[model samples]
Target: MTTTILAIFALVYLGMILGGLPFLQLDRTGVALLGAIALISLDAVSLQDAVAAVHLPTVILLFSFMVVSAQMRLGGFYSWATRGMANLPVSPPWLLGLLILMSGALSAVFSNDIVCLAVAPILAEACIRRQLNPVPFLLGLACAANIGSAATLIGNPQNILIGQTLQLSFAGYLQQAMLPVLLGLAACWAIICWQSRGNWQSSAPLPATPQLRSSDEQALDRWQSLKGLAVAAALLGLFLFSPLPHEQLALTGAGLLLMSRKLHSARMLGLVDWEVLVLFAGLFVVNHALQGTGLPATAVAWLAAQGVQLSEPWTLFGATFVLSNIISNVPAVMLLLPVASHELAGSMLALVSTMAGNLLIVGSIANILVVDAAARHGIQIDWRRHARVGIPVTLATLLICAAIFALRL
Candidate 1:
């Protein structure tokens, strides 16, 4: 049973790293779901155990925010913001600064993935319309989103998980994370702007803008956008001050958003990324099953004996940076959750995992979403193109975060 579970874990994470199994039409979510099902089918974990393994609060919180993001997307809030920024009449560098600032700030409150998904294509079009190169702006969107998401526990899925599991204070985490996130956002803009110095316009004529069926392209509905913004603002207030459980409060906000008369429930709920939720559920069960086998504990003990204590902040930070790039941030955080019982553990995990996503296109779902959104708009951001900016920005941001976190400690 142990061996089988281990094998399943290995295969599933392998699929995560590669994005799929060779010759198989499975994505990371599918691979994870399959692994969970396999464990139940083989009696490695009982159905009840599998269900219990999933952290319900984390799932609910993630779902609620996705609904909120969907509401804003349907209201065409993101598209409005993108167009508004593009026409600001500022110089290219200043426009770039505003783009990074807007992307980072929005992502700090909403889901980073959703922010990138909604903004990327429209940004591509706006850049093309202005006869500016879209590559730096697109990369900036993903980087800023990732960096800014680190500022709040609710900003990204992984941070939500770390917060819930560790029961960290929302305000406290914010206080610890804000400086690093700001510094990282600034570093991202500088790096991208510098890399884009010689080429602000494509040599060839801009390809026809791909038809985007994104929520950003939806007609801007002021009332709906305001409604979403109001809810988001109120929720953030509750998060900062109220004693209510974050999940319950977030869920309540989602339900309120669902009650709108004009926006059909189906359209709002349809925008939820059920696949991402499934991925979280599947990984929870798989990781739980592996934990039951006692290998993780034994390995941690062994590492400690060898003077490699993972509970220490620096060790965990290094491991998180490496694993996040390998298996992506969510799963990497799951793997490291065992040793993350330190006082600073939650913030360290959140910072490293979130910032590391800029290392490669596969490093974070935000990066993938940005790339996918751009591709749909007929813009190509190959790995090399992304790496040129991603590598330096990642190193600079990680160093800044490490310095800030160290000071906090």
Candidate 2:
């Protein structure tokens, strides 16, 4: 049983690293789900144990926020915000600053992937209309969204997992993460502006209007947008001051939005990333099965004997940075959560894992969404273009976060 579970774990993570198994037609989520099924079929984990392995609170919180993001999207809030930012009567550099600020702030509260997905094409159009380079702005959007999602527990899926699993206070985590997130956003803007020097103007001719799906070009719905904003704002207040479980509060907010007369629940729920939730459930069961083998504890003991501790913040930081790049942030967090022990481990994992996503285009879903959206509009941003901004922004943000964490020592 132990050997079987170990093999499944290894293969699933390999799929994660390679984006899929060869000739398998399976992505990371599919691989993980299959692994869990294999374990259950083998009786390595019973159905009840498999169900118990999943952290329902984390899953619920993630689902609830996805619903909230869907509401905002349906209401045209994201596109509206992007248009509002693009239409600002500011210089190119100033506009870049505003873009970073807006993306970061919005991502800190909502789903960064959804935020980027909704904004990317509209932003491409805006840049083309303004005769400015869209690459840097698109890069900024990805980087800022990645950084900003580290600000709060519910900002991203991984953060939600870490916060709930570690029992970290929502307000407490925010206090620790806010400074570094702010610094990182500023760094993103600076690196983008500096690298894009004297090249803000668009050199290539653009179409009179961007080619977009009708849904992508949503007009602002004032009342619906206001309603979503109100729910989001109220949730933030509750998260800060109330003792209510975040999952429940967010679900309440989602339910309230679903009860709206115009927008249907199916529309909002359809936008939820069910695959991501399945990925989490699958990993939870697989990891729990591995724990039954007692290998993780033994490995920790072996590492400690060799003076290679993983529970320490610095070690965890390095591991998170490497693993996050290798297998993506959410899976990396799940793999490392077992070894995390420091009081600040959750914060370290959440921030480092997220900020590391900017290192490469495949490092985060947000980056992928932006790149795909750009491709749809004939705005190509291959890995090389992304790295030009991503590499520097990642380095600066990680360094700033490390420095701040050091001060806490």
Candidate 3:
């Protein structure tokens, strides 16, 4: 049973690193789900244990916010906001700064990946319309969303897990993280602006891509948008001020959004990223099974004797930055959470793992979604194009965060 569990764990994480198994149609989510199933089917874990392994509060909180983001997306709020930013009459550099700030703020409240998915195509179209290069702006959107999501515990999936697992205070985390998040956004803006100085204009005559040329900007329903915003705002207030259980509060907000008379429940629920939810459930089970095997504990003991203390903020920070890039943020956070008992452990893991996503195109889902959105509109932003911005943006944000952590340490 132990051998099977370890084997399955290794294979699943390998799939995560490669984004999928070779010659298989499985994505990272599918890979995780399969590992969980294998563990149960092989009798390595009881069905009850598997179910118990999933942290219900984190899953519920994550699901509730997905529903909230779906409400905003279906009402065309993201599209409306993004288009408005793109159309502002300002210089390209100023326009870029505003885009960074806008996307960053939105990601702090909503799902960063969903924010990028909804905003990217609209941004691509807007850039084309202005005869400006869309690559840097798209990169800016991805980087800003990543950095801004680090500002709040509920900002991104990994942060959500770290906060719930460690029970970090919402307002307390906000206070510690906001400054670094702001400075990271500033650095992102400066880096993109510096790199795209003479290249802001479209270098070639862009072909008439239908997605970019289409006039069907999503119809923004004022009433629905207002309702969603009000619910979200109330939830944020409750998160900061109320002592209510976060999952319960978030679930209630989702229920209210689902009860909408105008937006059918199916549409709102359908927009939810079920794959991500499944991914979380699968990873929880696998990680739990590994913990049951005692190897993780043994490994930590050996590492401690070797002078590599994971509980220290500096070591955890480096491990998180490295592992987040290697196996993605959520899995890395899970692997590190056991030893993350330091006073500042939650904030350290959340901020470092998120900002690390800007280091490469594959580092964050937002980055990948933006690249795919650009591709659909005939604007190709290859790895090279993204790395030019990602590398520097990631380095700057991580540096600022590390410096702040140093002061605390």
Candidate 4:
């Protein structure tokens, strides 16, 4: 049973690295689900044990926030914000700064992926109208979204997992992460600015009138938007001051949002990404079964005996970077979570693992989504252009974060 579980574990994580077995026609989520089924069929883990391994709080918290972001998206808040930002007549440098700040701020509150999705189309259109280069702004949206999501526990799936697994304080994690996030956003802007200094002036003429769509031009529900904003603000305040569990507070807020008459309960529920929740639950069980086989701890001990330690922050940071780039961030976090401690090591691991996604277009799902959206609109963001900003920005921000961790922790 032990050997079988270990074999399943190795194959599952290998699937994670390769994104699936070669020519297997499966994704990370499919691989995780299969691994869990294998463990159950082999009796390596009972059904009850699999249920116990899945973390409900993390899953619920993630689901609740997705609802919140969906409400904002439906309300046209993102479009409103991006349109306002692009309408400004500032120079290219200031416009880049605006894009960075806006992307980071919105992503800190909402899912970075959604933020990019909502804003990218309008940003592309705005650039075309202004005759400005859309490539820099598009890359800014992706990098800023990735960097900004690091600011809070609720910002991304991996952060939520890290927070719940380690029982990290919401406010405390924010305090520890805000500096790096802010610095990282600035660094992103600096790199893009330097790269596009000569190309600042667009040769294309601004359109006679901005060609916004009817759907895009529809006014946001001021009341619904205000109410959702209020609920989100209250949740953040509770995170800072109240002793209530964050998951409970967030769930309550989601419940309140569902009770609204203007938006159907089913509609809001439909917006939840059920597949992602399933993926988390399935991976949790699979990883738990593998941990039960004693291989992970034994490996850690063996490495320690050789004067290497995975528990060290820097070591974990490096491991996480490589794992994240290979398997994607969420699965990488799942694999690393058992060995993580909530101190500087875990915090650094979470931040570095996420920031590493900015290194390549495929390094993060958000980047891929943005690229797909751009291509659909006849805007191609090739690898060379993306790397011009992604590589330097990722390296600079990761270094800044590493430095901050060394000095502060």
Estimated TM-score for each candidate: 0.97, 0.98, 0.98, 0.94
lDDT of 1 by residue, 280-365 (tens): 99999999999999999998999999999999999999999999998889999999998998899999999999999999888888
- Candidate 4: give its CA RMSD in angstroms: 2.4
Query: Over the stretch 10-65, how does candidate 3's per-residue lDDT look in tens digits?
Result: 99999989999999999999999999999999999999999999999999999999
Backbone Cα, N, C clashes tallied per candidate: 0, 0, 0, 0
Show model 1 residue runs off by greater than 4 Å: 209-216
Runs of candidate 3 exceeding 4 Å displacement: 212-217
Candidate 3 Cα RMSD (Å): 1.4
State model 2's lDDT: 0.91
Cα deviation at 169, candidate 3, in Å, is 0.3
**Candidate with more favorable, higher lDDT: 3 or 4:** 3
Tell me which residue pairs clash in candidate 4.
none
Candidate 2, residues 16-131, lDDT tens digits: the string is 99998999999999999999999999999999999999999999999888888888899899998899889999999899899899988899889789899999999998988888
lDDT of 4 by residue, 70-174 (tens): 778777788888888999989888999999999998888887887887788788788777778777888999999999999998888899899888988888888
Whole-model alpha-carbon lDDT for candidate 4: 0.84
For TM-score, candidate 3 versus 4, the one ahead is: 3
Worst 10 residues of 4 by lDDT: 201-210
